[model samples]
Target: METPNRQGRRRIVVGITGASGAIYGIRLLRLLRGLDVESHLVMSRSAHLTLNCETELRPADIHALADVVHANGDIGAAIASGSFHADGMIIAPCSIKTLSEIASGVTSSLMSRAADVMLKERRRLVLMVRETPLHAGHLRSMATVTDIGAIVYPPVPAFYARPASLEDMVDYSLGRVLDLFGLEASLAGRWSGVAAKRNPGDAAHVA
Candidate 1:
């Protein structure tokens, strides 16, 4: 059975790597806040640049959405240590650069350090690799990370959710990531499977 405090609210770590899809991290923060989950965020330098180019919101605004925001340079922060317990860590829009670093056990930045801690502590680590056209090196890195118990989740939207807008798509993707950590949220449209037949006439015979 899960502990009451642990089930009541999840402590999730959100890391935004140097990838093009900054919206994923931003949408995750918004949804996590709405769900009353405690979120810790770490944004890479390249992620900050992408945020400036892609979204109108500044880093401060994004930081405000999270319960705790840590500098990417702060390697000594509590989050970098395994003693600081958390439900999981999500590296949304994880770039190939960051993925390679984590795969190779390089803890140069706080985001990477937190991921290292998660791996060492046997905590959930979800890497949302956002690159297109994967190469052999990328596949090898993904395999290496998966072998070490890290999940390689690509930002693939589900059409079954019937997403009407970009926000809906973002929510669906982030919701799936949260599901890995056993956190519940209504970010995505609930899956009800295929609709029931309207009538007997709707049924067709196959030859």
Candidate 2:
């Protein structure tokens, strides 16, 4: 796939909700910046708390990474409108509450509202769901969103990439998510299964 074309710049709406993997959202912004993608960021109130709890970076730092920052309560933001020509939207570390809101189309905040716009416009929407041990209700919500063309992607690490650190794992997962939008990031290394298989000393060859 090729990068989206919009006035010679790829525009992506990024959302960060109250999920455990706050770093995913942060790394995603950094990667987008490196790729020269125009990013519109929106973060939930709970996301701020989660960011505070998980990382040392402040809200100012996050806001600086994006081309534009929309307040969570600002449902009137451009991204909340379907007419906005955005390539796609990605919610990294998508909280279950946020996911439920998006699935139900009861978006109370800009984050979910923007996500709803993506669906209504038939644009790509990727949710890096961060919950575990989900109940049936959570599963149902994921299925509903999937049926509506949203990709409910859990940030499952790719062991095939042989990630050496937490940063590597996070970048690889975000890179794969960006792949859904055709946005390439240098952080993720492509999987060379054939090359690994050809190496006699490789772990896969041993098995």
Candidate 3:
């Protein structure tokens, strides 16, 4: 059975790596704050560099969104243990290096350690791998993690949602991942029946 935190709130460990899409992690944290979930965040050193390059927010600004912030090097953190009693973990914009470390069961940082704990405890673990032009090595790593019960989620945008902005796209993806943990968020746009759009020279075909 799943356990909530001491305050009767679900706990989720969020990890951000050095991937190009840092906004995914940042927006996820914000979404958690509006829900009844406590977020424990740990970001790799490279994540800070990427965040700086991608946005104007400082590290402190990003850290403030989380309920608890852990150092990546702190392997002995609470979330690193199976007894920490977290609902699950989500590595937003997970980097290839982080994915490889988790897949190999050779966790070097607290983020990966926490992920390992989630797997051992039979808890939900989502890795939003952000990479393109993946080679065979990357595919193999993803398969290995999947075999061990970790969900390999790539944050691919869904144009079917008709997102008006980039934030809409990111929120929808993360919200769907949150659904795996049974935490519902309003950020994700629900898909209904397909709506067709026609142009001046186009004809609609009904089946």
RMSD of each: 3.0, 4.1, 3.1
* TM-score per candidate, chains pooled: 0.89, 0.90, 0.92
Model 3 per-residue lDDT tens digits across residues 1-207? 357878898889999999999999999999999986899999999999999999999999999999999999998888888888988999998999999999999999998999999999999999999999999999999999999989999999888787899988898898899889877897755767767777855654443
Clashing pairs in 3: none
Candidate lDDT scores, in order, read 0.87, 0.88, 0.92
Q: Which stretches of candidate 2 lie over 4 Å from their true place?
A: 1-7, 194-207
Regions of model 3 farther than 4 Å from truth:
195-207
Clashes of each: 0, 0, 0
Ranking by lDDT: 3, 2, 1
Ten-residue stretch with the least lDDT total in model 2: 192-201
Could you tell me how far off, in angstroms, the CA of residue 19 lies in candidate 1 after the best superposition? 0.3
Clashing pairs in 2: none
Instruction: Give the per-residue Cα lDDT of candidate 3 at 182.
Output: 79
Question: lDDT value for candidate 1?
Answer: 0.87
Top candidate when judged by lDDT against the true structure: 3
